[model samples]
Target: MSYFDLSKFPPSSAASDDGSVSSLLSISPRSSRSIILDQSFFDAEDPSPSPRGLAEPPPQRSLPAINDALYSVQVNNRRRSTNSNTTTSVSSNYDSDSSGRSGRRPIKTGEMGTSSERESDGEVRYQEKKSKPKPKKKVSVVISGGDKVKRNGGIRMAPLNVPIKRRLQTAAVLLHGFTIPLYTSLFWFLLAIPLTWPILIPYLIYCLFSEAHFDGSAPRRRSHFLRSLPVWRLYTGYFPLKLHATTSLDPAKNYIFTYHPHGIISHGAFGHFCTENTTGFEGLFPGITNTLLTLDSNFRVPFYRDFLMFMGLASVSRRSCEALLRGEAAQPPPTWSAWKPWTWWRLVFLLPIFHPAPHYTAPTGGGRAITIVLGGARESLEAIPGRMALVVKRRRGVLRIAIRENAGIVPVLSFGENELYDQMVPTGGGMIEKLQMFVKSVAGFTVPLFHARGVFNYDVGLLPYRKEVNTVVGRPVFPKAQMESPRDGDLDEFQERYLAELRRLWDEHKDVYAKGRLPGKEGEMVFVG
Candidate 1:
């Protein structure tokens, strides 16, 4: 996988929403002490005297100037009282610059006064439209170690004035969003109690025989209704998730979406693909049934297995991959899956039966999509917020599969995935790293040492940090026609193209989608084996 490091970079210097402004802001803890700014600090009023030999430090290093800037919004806002802290707080620096945007032009006083009116009988009446002065730019300043966050406004959606009931409902939604993953184990653990054994035994018996563990195509599992529920919308919306498409896909084709840098969990993939009515995936790209693929191990989880199926999730395994993409229970070529032995009867059964997905069902189905979290567990170790690192150079499994299935590859990047949690990456080759590696070898996944703001506080919780996550879906890269035994070099070539597209997407939109991700340097997407 790739590598990541924690940044000492502060949030105040982050980019403005829409990237219209690039001012560096320093947000310190809210001090009760009144900030003092000397008149000489103003660059326009009194330029500081230059030293004989040494150059001056930049304006950023000057505390008085920072204070003056932090408190200068009072005059700009036309507040009568500059003494009131509310008028000049640092948060006001984040206000939306709507007047500067196109189309919605604010009226200017000069233009208003220029309009003249004529009256009958040589009596002329002048008419002037009153116009409000444009508001200054504002940005939300999240001060560390203090609850006194001055969120005056910038770069985020405007908060709604909801009733108390709605506020409580939102809280409930957040709580549910966070707890749903853990609830699976919790459900079984409760059922394990002696009094509940009767119900638990039958469920266990049913689960033991269920093909839901291996076959995602099972009719009962993929419930379109459950995927359409309001709860799923709340779950996805808790991140206030956004789904963007670089371009629409053709309904006649199948696609393979490879999601990068699997942050803690591929929550973005789930929010974007697994639910349709909520994230509006269907409305955006109609006629495509998208399956968000995951490690088969998740299908082994109690209660959670069923939920994954209901959400149209399937195993990201060799047999499962071939079946979903090609619409047949075809065992991947021996080169793809070295272990599974093949039989001719299985091939024979599929010769006359399959249609390729009709609504896009196999045989008559519209075409289908299979999304894989390309970076998997190893990459999660590198999932530090604000840094973009990917483990894609050696990620040829999905590419090979896509080539074999003739599925177009679509690169999906979640701009704020890593921001959901702060991870603790043990030093390379250190004991902790070795232990994590050992666990992954035996158990198929490694746990990253990670944490996020709690439900109660902003620093210790299982709930994902309440940062906006924008997932941009790029145009598809159509793989060469079906190759039963695709060449390794050809697969690598496709991967290079895929990686290039991902980098292109990042390079193009980082300013907007991942603004303030890295300061001083442009954010880089690294590819380590």
Candidate 2:
């Protein structure tokens, strides 16, 4: 809509020879910036993940600040009476014809043309500063007696030590955190019953053929409402997980994040990478879409399958990994597709020998990343609170996938992961350890005989302890001079370089991140695969 002054036309500034008078025209200076910037607009629908709901600190910009701010001239559109009916330049506010909010009617882009064009159009020259909004001050109040009272505060969050309100909130969150695992376990039991076969059979068959589970169908994971549920925030506050980037990762490159020391459930990986809402990971590493990979066996279960998928969990199995890397319809599991239905049982029996189910294998457009708890179940055996023991020593599963996919690797070291649970791992040959190993050997996964503090007390439950878990993502290690089917020597060389990088990362910050660990030496680590 074009804006103009509404007033009786003033008499012509000059008379014509025929004694006829013309209305005087008023002109003003105004900037039409929108028209200038219109041709430079670009499409911003990039696939890169953007930051959402994160309270990140302001970035440290390297560019020098501008010394002066320049603003374009605008216009005041109200009309007024002048002593003479002549062309005149004016720079004063005029009354509005409406209910009267008194402010200059700023010039808008596209409203008028060039200065000469505007002069011909009878516009007035106006000079005014651009309007600026006033900054609002944030006030903090201590909630005592329900009356607001200002309090001085520092950059740190309030301590969660003894506040009754905060404690109650924590208790609720602890309960909510249990809901997922409890429901998944419960679904496994309920769905396995013969009575539920009619429903279970159909769903399982559907999952068998459907590609959604592995085709990057991640709408659910991106749901801000679900991902940012207060429960996760509480879960985060419970151990109070923190994610760090030792070096920034380029969004233009794909990555395989190999997480170490898969303590118990690999809770560190879940809190940091599984949910973008939980950690504001995009704020830390913008444009990288990180999906946490889990056992394909997890997806074989009924409700549990959907639950994991909703949380953006993908199968770590070979074909599943390959499918994700290629971003195509998932190729069916080898045994399932290759073996006869009558031979399925025997195929399951031979699974361990044929396929190490929980492992992943990459792409272009280059924004994808998968978080692999590289230690798998073996690391759970070495999980000792306050100590750094990883089964990554001989674990080349991730490297194998990395080499095949040619994806860069990053070692993700999550300190204090083991401290969250106290696992009861007896010596190697004990009956209990034997049973655990048997389960792992047959089923490909073993539940750690672990415990953490309960909601009501400081002992005996599945809840992780209230310790600080800092996950630092080390620098990317790109394998150089590699072949599609990499040689063993080449793989070893890359692994050695990766190990050095992992060590460098730990040695550089272990003192700070593992600060409150049980008074251990700097390099007392158990890194076995």
Candidate 2 runs further than 4 Å off: 1-181, 184-201, 208-211, 215-224, 329-364, 518-523
**Position 529, candidate 2: lDDT:** 54
Q: Write the per-residue lDDT of candidate 1 for residues 474-506, one digit (tens) a residue.
A: 889877567878887788778778878888898
Residue-level error in angstroms, candidate 2, position 355: 33
Steric overlap count per candidate? 26, 15
Best by TM-score: 1
Residues 1-529, candidate 2, lDDT per residue (tens digit)? 1111111222121222233321111212243222121111112232333322334432332212100101222222323314454343344333222445433344444544575565454434443443468896867444322323333343212333446754755675466566557766776786779886655555567666655555654322233444556667766766678988888888877789999878887778888886656776889888776778887776766565656665667877766565555544223334444333323322433423232223321234676778889888888878888788777768776787788877789999988888878877788488988898899999998878788755544455666666778888899998885456788888899899999998988888888887756564633665755
TM-score: model 1 vs. ground truth: 0.61
